[model samples]
Target: MPADDSPTGLSQPLYLCVADELGQLIAQGQLAAGERLPSVRELSQRRGLSPTTALAALRALEQRGWVEARPQSGYYVRPKLRRLAEPATSRPPSAARPVTVGSIAARLLAASNEPGIIGFGAAIPEADWYPVATLQRLASQAARRHRLLIGEYSPFFGLPALRHQIARRYAELGIAVDDDEVVITNGCMEAINLALRTVAAPGAVIAVESPTYYGLLQLIEAQGMQALEIPTHARDGLSVEALATALTGPQGAQIRACVVTPAFCNPIGALMPEAAREALVALCRQHRIALIEDDVYGELDFAGQRPLPARYWDRSGNVLLCGSFSKSLAPGARIGWLLAGRHRDAVRMRKFTTSAGTALVYQHALSAYLETQAYPRHLVRLRRLCATNVARYIEAIERYFPAGTRVTRPSGGFVVWVELPRGTDTLALYERALFRRINFAPGPLFSASGRYRNCLRLNAGRQWTPDVDGALQALGRLVEAG
Candidate 1:
């Protein structure tokens, strides 16, 4: 076969083109489950391709759930696993309520890095998964080259080079953002906080997805604001129709801002369709409410396409976009960015008052890394690993969890929202799991109104180990005992 012989006639990577052909055979039942696939050399010879390309195709198939690799053996077609039922669309109360989050989330974060603990609590990935050594080397080189700048603070909007890199990334996603419009933030949280401060005030009503990220709830609580919960789907994301209805209700006019994670939202892992995203942007514009998008997980889509942020649909500069490398790259770097659109100045001032400026060394190092065009390559590996891990986690949950448990089938990101049998009281279950060195985020922490008592969220970002499986079994047994 010629190098350009993609069945789809598109200019995709050669490995993906080959993987698609193999995947089609699997889908058509030509490649039966449990059947061993051709060896790398055999495949290469058969396809008139190189061994490296053939191996890459097999790995791609493995990542896509079409095949599996065995130790010391070639790949085999993966058997279809039973799919778990997904959690239903959330139905939070229609009225706006005061944010009253508790210390559970903080406690979880505090214990996240503890040794001997199985971390299913935090969405953080293992450090080894990151290009840590490469970053360290880059940082050292930056320090040597710019030793005098070490004593100086980063610009309030961050290093111009880093801002340019961030803007270039957004441009790749078809979002036209000037580098000057981007603010370097400590992390996505600070970017969001700055957005909230710029748009809403104390006691203001903020529209949020029901069962949103716990950190967002904490942010609202810290600001003494009220949360107007909007029902969100398990898969499709925040209900645009529901949000529109709420916006026109008695509480609608008072809502100062709408915060959404249109791409793989935390816990529930919802990916809003493009139509919904466009509608959301338009609705916020009509209501004159700020659309603050937390797009930290936007680039982690397993489908190989980086999902566009809601900010992509902004026509009048009403969207405030927040993203971070914490999820995709080095979390310890504390690097994130914000595009505040028309609110850029206010956000910059807020960022200045909040943290003065982000660290410059990491920004310089990251900028250098981006210049090498390595970030995209890094994401390809990370996304593939995350997709495999997510599949493993969901399969384990289905096999080990209680009979009535339902989990989210996230197409992106590395977390899943699990709904246990009614009255399971996951908070109680969480405490029990904690005693066994197991940790998972209980459902109530994801909401301000103390909802989802029978729910929990598990982290698929962690490296899978025998200990993890044991912990899952232990958790299942504990639930059964209760």
Candidate 2:
């Protein structure tokens, strides 16, 4: 073991810092596979840490799949997971088209909850993955603390404390924001909706990443707006050059807004690079287009650092930054927020008319949770679990799926986009898989043009289990039979 440094002035927990350092060593091949790790006692003595902290670091490593423990033996470096080639960049039609995603999304959601079904459909985190007990306790405490206000409607934007916490997080990203500028929403769904309503008029064209989140498509469809699907990379995220072409061409005049998930986009899990993000912000600003950023998955980066959102470069106030705690915390809490730069008032109006305000209890509870260091600690564990589970899913797909199956190597988030061989209709595959009590997101739901017929999005949020493995094998067999 190398000499450890003092943990003063660290950004995250001391144990997390130690674990990250050790994990990097393992990643860099300094700690070969199957090599025994230093015992907790020795590690503590050498690093001048307490036994509890040293053991916690090792346990964190175990959770993140950096090392494993054996009976009467200390932790040992685990073998690296196999990586598959990522899917190619998407090529949806350049022209803006009306979104018409039907009831498939709802059907998938319903099927995902059915008994006997192995759900790999919805992007929701597994229930057990959350700090349910802690959240519940906080909720109870909030109820007692704000009992008089529980029956009354919350403030138009939200509780001040929660908004301040949200603002504090953005400040960490180097974005200056006032707590009063934040508006609470039902979830990222409503935040996007509010942003859309505030920025674009009905029947206007909204640009989006090809094979984008179906929820965004549905929102566009519901608002009677047209979506111009831009070509998107499976790894590098929204192609700024492709978008630039669209914005400068004949249809450029028609574009009113661009909705993007820059970090760990759903379905595809693409992390737009910092350069791309800056260019995107500049492009949107140049074209006078509203850039609505859905940053719900921003905190789930596997690399332990949150990528700066496209909003980070917006000086003209054209960027509407949206985020939610659903992915990193409790989804049922339904707590989401928006930092609508120039359209703050408009968004507030939209939010007031649409949902009045978010539930006060959740806002209070989440605020209380944020006041403690528990949220950061919980996020550390959540990110590790998500990284491990995503790797497991990719490995299983490589081992079980048909040949020519390509999966995204997401650096963050809990979903992977899988592209099977051409002529493989995943909708058809999904029908059969459901018949066998298996559920996964069919790719057609991801596009306004109903593209990606051979592709599908797998939820890698669940822990590895025999049932999940068996389901994957069965799904592979079904694909083969076709």
Candidate 3:
């Protein structure tokens, strides 16, 4: 029962070590399903540990689906259940097609935030998930203390204090980020936009995931660039081999940059393996293509360890790391930052000339909040909540969705990608779902070539409730009918 006792004890806590060992045994078939686990005291005695440690390990196992608790009967390996299939790796066309999507896409998004809609459509974390009350109080305090600076413009790179905090957080993630080089923007999208405009020209080609965030595709389309879709896995993220192939193909020479989420990519919620990240950086460095990383979802990891960003391997400054509080902290704060390795000066200049700067009040408020609560501490609790929500959503999907429906299980983030049975048209379902007052992202919107006709993405950012549960059940019926 020592204070040092952790769950699993693998990495995050001592209990994780215990949970990991048990999970491995179960996966290896050594601990057969339905077999009984040791009693808390027996586990402690057998493993030369304390009772608390044993109990904690068992609890971690239960949380991760390795075991189940049966009241006074002790823990038992959970019965193996047939889960929904995962989506297959994407194989988008190799040609780099010019962006043609326009304002209609914008009009569809315009009604996304409308009230009275049961929203599972947007990628944003629900307002109920954030520490909004605390943020509002902090904003009020910042406004009172810096009343004179209320209407003042933030520095060209944002408030020094906020930049300092952002830099500190990046350092924790193993990026040697320079605060001076960081350019703050309206949000992650703006940071990405600025980085894109800074590196590639309007007509240049950019390599992107076959199925990526709609916002990213929209940006590519809005910038008048051509998109060379690279094959991507539903769980493993962008394929480096595919990207290399694209880089060497007839259209490869036209590709100036490769934009990716790297960690929990939107729509698919995929994370590139550490080795893949290194390779991606090397590929970009060798080919002289810029690596634009969208790290907004980086902090939402369900696993305790945050994936190392592609920015960590950028030795030649070919990487542009974009981050924001929109995904992790305040949604409306609109505070985003970018670290452009060699293009720092140009990005800063471009951003300055275009937008001047972000609001000082929010900058100061965020800086103060981060200083007081150290983002890491908040993330720990947030991650645990998100993990639980993801589990609930997955349970609902497995129980209610059609038998042939496939889904994604991400290591981090709150979004899940669903691939319906072949010939199922989600666009038609989108209309029906809307009519029924349930909102979810239709698959076609996530692509430029209008692919993913039967795919859909759902947001699990909101806490599970009875109403949501009913909505999911109803959606299941809707999908079945489709």
Q: Which model, 2 or 3, shows the larger TM-score?
A: 2
Number of backbone-clashing residue pairs for each candidate, in the order shown: 0, 0, 16
Candidate 2 stretches greater than 4 Å from native = 1-83
* Backbone clashes in model 2, listed as residue pairs: none
In angstroms, the error of model 2 at 345 is 1.0
lDDT of 1 at 333: 91
TM-score for candidate 2, residues paired by index: 0.86
TM-score leaderboard ranking = 1, 2, 3
- TM-score versus the correct structure, for each prediction: 0.87, 0.86, 0.85
The local distance difference test score of each candidate is 0.86, 0.86, 0.82
Q: Kindly list the per-residue Cα lDDT of model 2 for residues 3-89, writing each as its tens digit.
A: 111123233477876776676567546788999999999999999999999999999888766689998988999886544578889
Off by over 4 Å in 3: 1-81, 101-104
Question: Candidate 3 has what TM-score?
Answer: 0.85
Shift in Å, residue 281, candidate 3: 0.7
- Per-residue alpha-carbon lDDT of candidate 3 for residues 143-196, written as tens digits (9 for 90 to 100): 899867756655777899899888998898777887898788899999999999
Q: Could you give candidate 1's per-residue lDDT for residues 242-338 as a string of tens digits?
A: 9999989999888999999999999799999999999999999998999999999988998799888888889899999999999998899999998
